[model samples]
Target: MPDYKKNSISLTGAVGLGTGVMISAGIFALLGQVAELSGSWFPLIFIIGSIVTAFSAYSYVKMSQEYPSAGGIGMFLVKAYGKGTITASAALMMAVSMIINQSLVARTFGTYTLQLFDGAQTEWLVPLLGVGLIVVSFLINISGNTFIQTFTSIASLIKIIGLSTMAIAGIIVADFAFTIPNKASNPPDIGIVSSVAAIALTILAFKGFTTITNSGEEITKPKKNVGRAITISILVSLSVYLLLAWAVSSNLTLSEIIAAKDYALAEAARPAFGDFGVWFTVILAIIATITGIIASVFAVSRMLAMLTEMKLIPHKHFHMPGSIQKHTLVYTVVLAIVLTVSFDLTRIASIGAILYLVMDIMIHWGVFRHLRKKVNANPFIVVSAIVLDLIVLSAFLWVKFQSDIVVVVVAILMITFIFIGEYAFLRKTSD
Candidate 1:
């Protein structure tokens, strides 16, 4: 271990990092898909998703209390499952999912920004901008923790206030009639099953709370503050998501939302306050995505560094300069850039969501079945977390399987390859 400084971030810094990741571009990009499944009640779906997320958060909260480390979930998994392929694979899945998230956010930055331009439908514009952002984030990340914290705190504040203002503005201008402009091909009656299933997708909006746990070692008081940070991040994110969903649902018709699905919030703004509103929402998105990528890269790189120190996964440097953490930062950014360039936005989001929920399921189950007594965690909460994750994950997988089987297969193959590669590496190192 490199003995990095502990307690580097204050309480506000921790919360900022949490919100930086949670209130991400994912919210902007994913609203339409969730609404398609959820119909007119999409805002309520966000509320329901928060309840489901609360259950999943229980395991992480308890684990952080018992074992606070920079390693975060990686450390928790090691405690529950030991230093083996399982821990290594789970951690890598998480790291990769976050990398995918950076790409998702980066691409979102591109999509939203281009909306400000005329004839902005160029083919290569999005990935180019996405890669540019990743490079910028890498530079900012290497500058040190204070800069990262300060910038993220300020950005988080701006994004939250901007989103709130948009919501309120939309509400003030709305006529209170909630109606979908173009009726869907499916029946108008959206049942509870469909709404509950939509929780699988909506969960993505709040999943970034785990980014806070990755900074456990840096928080001023890990045991007390990590939990608080996670709780605050989710609550604030949920509030923002609901407000935006309400604003969009109330202001824009269903067809308008789906029509500008790539940039729904911005499109919704057009009807509410015209071009100025459009620019306002796009600017907020650009800021949100930039901060989101930086926060994610910061946390995931530290996590990979921790995993390397634990020797649960393979690590090598081609005579790189700076610390192991810096090398990990490079690796994280490069991989994210590749995903940004290669995959489309929807595919990247699906891959990330699947990897994340699967990893969450493993974490919850590992704790529930093995470490419940060890950590003094409530078995029921752990169990509920596992069950909720299972239901949501199953719903998500089924939906993807029906809509895009290739993504699900790709995700499964990625997981399998990570496990096999880890096992082989461990065997060789042991020998």
Candidate 2:
């Protein structure tokens, strides 16, 4: 049995972990992509995304209140669906989605860091830096929870302050006015479907709250604090995202933001504070992405270890020495590195968004269908989460199919493979 350290994580540290993950590449890397999809009014999507996520969080908060465990979503799934294929597959999907998120943040780290160096060959260096950062995060995580918590807590504080200052300064420089394209000037035609689909990416920005649940077994006052940390993290992220989005829009036009999508934050800085601003933004990005990976890897490995401990997934020592958590840490980093090397940012975010939303829908439905009465959750909120997730997910899929069918296909294949593999494993074990 894995020895989870109870009371090792405090409420503040839990909030650190949550916001640490939320404020990373989610805002720095994805702002422009959301803008591209939603046009000049992209900032509004962050608000809508938060509202949607709040509904989804109701089920998770209720579940955590009832069943706090290191397994997090994995534990929740087993409670709702039992230790069956549905549980295992959905749990695995959540794990994989988190790993996908790590790679996304890692690559974002590379992209933003490279802004400090002009004329550098980025084709290979971006992945190289990303891999290097993931390795460092692995080292930090292995040092134990205390060090990870301290690092994330401090890093989260720095990022929140740095980004907030930058956003506020930029807005002030722009005289608190946004350069929204005039309707008569014929801006990019952003449809309602496109704007709703953009919510998928924005929700990805806030989904880091779920990481708080993964540490429930270690948090002080797991039942009350887990939910509190999640709520606080979401509200904090919403504030930062809104201010930053407005700041970016205030500084740069929609075309410029879309053109510099991958490193939009850095570009947004240039217009407000010149080269110094760009450097500041890059430094903040580096901190945010590094800490983000540390926090994410910390949660993801534990969740996977929990799955292994529950015998929901098969594990191999591979001649590696250490506990199951250590092994899962290695597995998590390797997978993230592979993804960072294989996919570009756009496709990566696409895949993560699709997987996450699908898994989220499963969670809500599970709660509503089986655990609502037991958990004392509102049926309306649970079903509303399901409906909202489905709407955004469908719109996101439609948008992806129209633009990038390959991403849609890859997401579908991944979901199919997970369910099929879990089914085979469970059958073999039962027999």
Candidate 3:
């Protein structure tokens, strides 16, 4: 085996990694859907989502500070649950959800790209493009961590500058773009349940911060940089989200937004900066999705490598001579391809959001019950995280149950199967 060199990712590089993993096409596509729920108050709803995510981040930050490892959340679960059925099951759920999320962003990449052309809405094109990007990401990842870090940093820079320009330009043009008061045009009577439901999707937008934790070992100053990277990334994401949401809501009326819900930002760009804005926004969406997929594949493959080392999951050599991370990268891309081809965008996002929230709840509960005192983490924050997750998850389920019952059922089935399979595997290994 060739000795692998240690990755020397700096704090800024770690922050870039986190941002690139997050700032994906989810925000590009879901703004209109969130607007439908929160109406004119989508900006405030984004902030609410950030606050809730912060509560959950508290547990992760505290635990990661005490126990910084490349094992990421899996290590946290083992420490809290003691390597039993519960730890294995929760880790599996989180991993699967992340895999599902890759498919979501992959399809989003295809969706946003097709927006550039007329009659581009073919059923096969989306999955084809998604799988193609996954293959590209796999090749880059196997090249090594240094290459991945350098590529993501550049992608992250372009993404930030593009989005910031769009947001600022939109805000500046909102004054002359439409003289009518947006509030008078549409008054949203969104109740508490609807607001909570909107935050569920918003939470998905911030889920990329968890990707940073997976890179804990690679980051310089693992103890301090890990938490700092997560915090800084979330703040940056929140700022960009709020600014863009305000821009969209300000320039576009409720009807216009809902009409172009599939590609809201691109549509909003048209009115703000005309044809150029449309092209710019679409290009940004493409970049965001591309980098997002690359960063995500990097994190999830590393996570699976960790899982294999712990013997929580089965692995195969496949006659390939490479390190554990290389093999896991192949497996990760293959699974993502399967998911991309099988599910549509809405169903994929539904499964990813539900599974992730469920796993997050388990993480918070584990800490609250077992590791809180040991880690010196605040009990109130842990409890608040649990409560917030439960409320948002319930609201999201209710929304999906009413609109897309099939997706919700599939999510439940997926969760059940993961738990049962992990338990059986662990039992067999013990015997």
Candidate 4:
């Protein structure tokens, strides 16, 4: 049996756990892409992304109140449908998305780290850094949550402090680059669509509630704290994101920014703080991303643990403790291999972001569907949730359809693998 602890974390800790796990992508890197997409509408994009995500967070709280457990959205999807292949597929995706998300961060961290020094290419530096991050976090996992939780708390603090410091620094030292009123624009084209998609990409920076779910075994007050932490985490993360967007946008012209393209935060910081700014951000990125990697390693390990227990995966793989802990280390090493081999942080984060969005939407969609039919909750509320989620799904699919054919194919292949894996598991169990 799993040794469960009650309220090991305060309600505040639950919220911090979510924000801590997810906010690395949102803050340390993403300004350049967001600025490019929003054009003159960066502020609007930030607010819109926050509003939509706020609703999604609310859905999570509502669902958590109903079915709180460490299983995350996997459990939510499973219980709603009475458990089947669809549930199996959902859990598999969640498990993979968590892996993909961390890889994206690990890659980003490596890239940013190498960039700190002159004539250094973040391209190669990032991969090695990614492997190192996996190794470090894996060690943290073995000590158990007693150590892991405290370390994660520190990582969470680094993220907030770094971002806040950057925002404040930008305000004090960096120039405010606001859009001129009444800038003429044309009808939206593929260029525009891609740009909006990029801004939507900014939303990915704030997605990390699963870390809290993965830590479910450690959480003391599961029901109350899970929902509480998720909500607070998203809100705090959003606030930081909004501040970042504003800081970066304030430092460059809509046109100079769109032209300069990538890493606007670094470029913006360079002018105001000069050498101080660049070095500070580089160090900050390293610290913030290290924190993110730890959070990611923890989340994926637990998700794997849950899937193994549910019989959807081979029983031997779930590392509960002792022998099981090795599974977490193995998963960490596998992610390191993926991260070390990959150089393109944007593409990596892009694929990860899209896959995660699909899972999040599906998780919420399953909840809404269940509440509407089985629970017979308020039709009006349920309809609103469904309608809003439909908008999110449409946006997600539309963007995915336009950008990468690989993501779509990969998603299908992943689902295929899940069924095959599950089928093989059942066969072994019967024997």
lDDT on C-alpha atoms for all candidate structures: 0.86, 0.93, 0.83, 0.63
TM-score of 2: 0.98
Model 1, runs deviating above 4 Å: 1-3, 176-194
Residue 170's lDDT in candidate 1: 89
- lDDT value, residue 206 of candidate 2: 92
The stretch of ten residues in a row with the least summed lDDT in candidate 1 is: 178-187
List of clashing residue pairs for candidate 1: none
2 versus 3: better TM-score goes to: 2
**Per lDDT, what order, best first?**
2, 1, 3, 4
lDDT (Cα, tens digit) per residue for candidate 1, span 120-202? 48879999999999999999999988999999999999999999998878877886555444455334645566666678767
Q: Between prediction 1 and prediction 4, which has the larger TM-score?
A: 1
* lDDT value, candidate 1, whole model: 0.86
Residue-wise C-alpha lDDT for candidate 3, range 155-236, written one tens digit per residue: 8889888898889889888762433325554535556677788898888888888888877777788889889999999998
| CA-only RMSD, every prediction | 1.7, 1.2, 2.3, 3.5
Please name the candidate that would achieve the greatest lDDT relative to the true structure.
2
Question: What's model 1's lDDT at 202?
Answer: 76
Candidate 1 has what TM-score? Answer: 0.96
lDDT of 4: 0.63
